[model samples]
Target: MDSVKLGLKENWKQFALLVIVNGFVGGMVGMERSIFPQFAEVEFGVASKTAILAFITAFGISKAVANYYTGKLANKFGRRTLLLFGWLLAIPVPFMLIYAPSWTFVIIANILLGLSQGLTWSSTVVMKIDLVGEKDRGFAMGLNEFAGYFAVGIVAFITGYVANSYGITPYPFYIGVFLSIVGFLLTLFWVKDTRDFVKKEGKNNKTVELKNVFLETTFKNKTLSSVTQAGLINNLNDGMIWGLLPMVLFSLNFDNENIGIITAIYPAVWGIGQLFTGKMSDHYSKKGMLFWGMLMQGIAILFIPYSSEFAVLAGLSAILGLGTALVYPTFLATIAQATSPQQRAESIGTFRLWRDLGYAFGAIISGVTADIFGVEYAILTIASLTIMSSLIIKFRMPVNIKTVRK
Candidate 1:
């Protein structure tokens, strides 16, 4: 007799725990979101956009590598081991950030942060897919991302306020210390490996196996490749927002507290909107959702530099968030549906590799462009690329078929 169960309720305990762990994972990243770009300039005396965005570059490169390996290794070593190791890398990140002597040290800290995020976040994503099986993968991914990013919004907002009150260095990073320790303890004691669940799910999934998963997920296969490019551009715009948004807000005369609030609004809306959109993937056409989501995002980003008023900026931020929410979880769900369970983790990891590399590309492209052509052109340029991405998905990708466990 084979043992396999699908649906969120059956695995709620483990599902919920993974969600909690991922929240901490997200919080770890969020700690820097609102503060770091400006911190690089003001405290460290870094002036160039390229130099200021160096941390994001390091993080994207390292995390992309980690994401690729975590997928390859999750099955061999077990998800629990990767999760713990990720936290171990995180242990030193806060201290390094808090006590850094110069900008070089900060860049090193972000590299470690990248390692932690890749390992822990990837492990949690694979684990949740394992637990929920196939029927509710969209909802599962949505909830998972919601937990992580909502924490990101909350932490970003809090750290901003903390920086405003007590100065940017040392104080704002204290939350990282707390998150790392708590996340480690929880994973060590509560998280369980779900590799068996994946095997069980695979037995039920009758999809054709992927040959050369790396090639298929990357470019050889049309649908997988299409999804891959869209994911990359999605994060590319995100990377732009991470490094440019605060600078834009600051230029408009917003204080740290206001910057934080405005920044928080984007992820907050992104995190919250997924509750419905995730499930929508289950019932609607994946291609249609991806098309419109990217469209909305491109339009929102194009208009960001035009709005200097705080209220208008905040509303635009929320619209950007909505666009992201529509597609973020759908990316994972589409990959999960496209490949056999045997290849799902690897494919997902490969997708994430390109997706996260967007952070680096986005940062570099936007940063250097802003340096040369002004920030508005940088914004306009990425927006045009985003629209191109949407067109690619619309014309190239096949409709993703919905599936469920036996």
Candidate 2:
């Protein structure tokens, strides 16, 4: 831990770059997420229920695909080049959504947005693990997720307010475009390659192999498998919360402002709570942190349908956030610890691909369920799925911590 801490402190420039690039990437995605549902409703006259699903489906599919390639690209070309390319792809995203002649254009933008997410955001997480090594990985991941989601929560609320005031959804898209351009430029001008970190450690001379990069080797380790599975479930719940919560509020007859306030609470709490949770991961077993986090998330989801008042719902949202905070960083730390340093990028990418697929699976399932039954029923179903996932982790998985060295 002391050596890891010293390395991070000495490489402050690299870590600062990670924080800024990842934070901006988060804000870019957050901007889209904040406004897309309203755009679907106001521009295409799509129902709130159906439109949100479009964004989720596009995001899930594109991110899933991009996760596979991002690792390979990072391995072949190096992380900085791939990251720069990803930021460039983001430049047109907001314009596509804002000037979209049909819902299909907005969907296309989301696909591109998802690509940016996988390439930039997912890669940044892997990069952090690269820089921080094993011992301080939890704290590093906590800071990473905290910056990203906190930007999302704040930007979502602000953009939601912008939409309500102007009654023009494109305004937010325009803002997203500008921010993404800034992020792109920042990466181009300021961010440096951490491949030097790997090179400095003399691992860069090894042959790059693609075989088994995406295979059972990933699942061969019990600890890695548990963390990966838990990550999938955690992201499954995240997809539900981000994909369906607004519609849940809409179904309850809340306006955009109220929806924004309610929607903001989950990520806000999740983001802020990481400060403590990240430190806790250092002192406790990663498995213990994850197990309790999943349990709390399940309990929070169960409480969602029962809360009729905004205050109670907000409280439940915070509880869910805390649960997410507990699990999110620990999961990343576990993945970093379980894999060899040389293969960390590919391993984390593979892990994220599975976790992100949970978003697609949860969205399609919950969307169809909501269409058939109602929002409350959809919430209940996701709650049940989450609880089942928690049980799987608690009972079936081994509780152990593994660490790899540089």
Judge candidate 2 at residue 159 and give its lDDT. 77
Q: Write the per-residue lDDT of candidate 1 for residues 146-263, one digit (tens) a residue.
A: 9988999999999999999999988999999999999999999999898889878766578888769999899987778988999999989988999999999988889999999999
The CA lDDT of each predicted structure is 0.91, 0.76
lDDT of 2 by residue, 1-406 (tens): 2233325667778787888777788888678554556567778888846456767777888887787688766767878788888888888888887778998887888889888888998778777766765457788888888888887887788777887788656677777877788888888887766665654443423433334656732465666677777777787778878877876676688877777787888888888788678778878977788888988998999888877798988889889989999998887777666555566677778888888887887777778888888878888888887777777777766776644333
| Winner by lDDT | 1
RMSD in angstroms, all models?
Answer: 1.7, 3.3
Error of 1 at 312 (Å): 0.5
Q: Pick the candidate with the highest TM-score.
A: 1
Instruction: Report the Cα lDDT for candidate 1.
Output: 0.91
lDDT of 1 at 351: 94
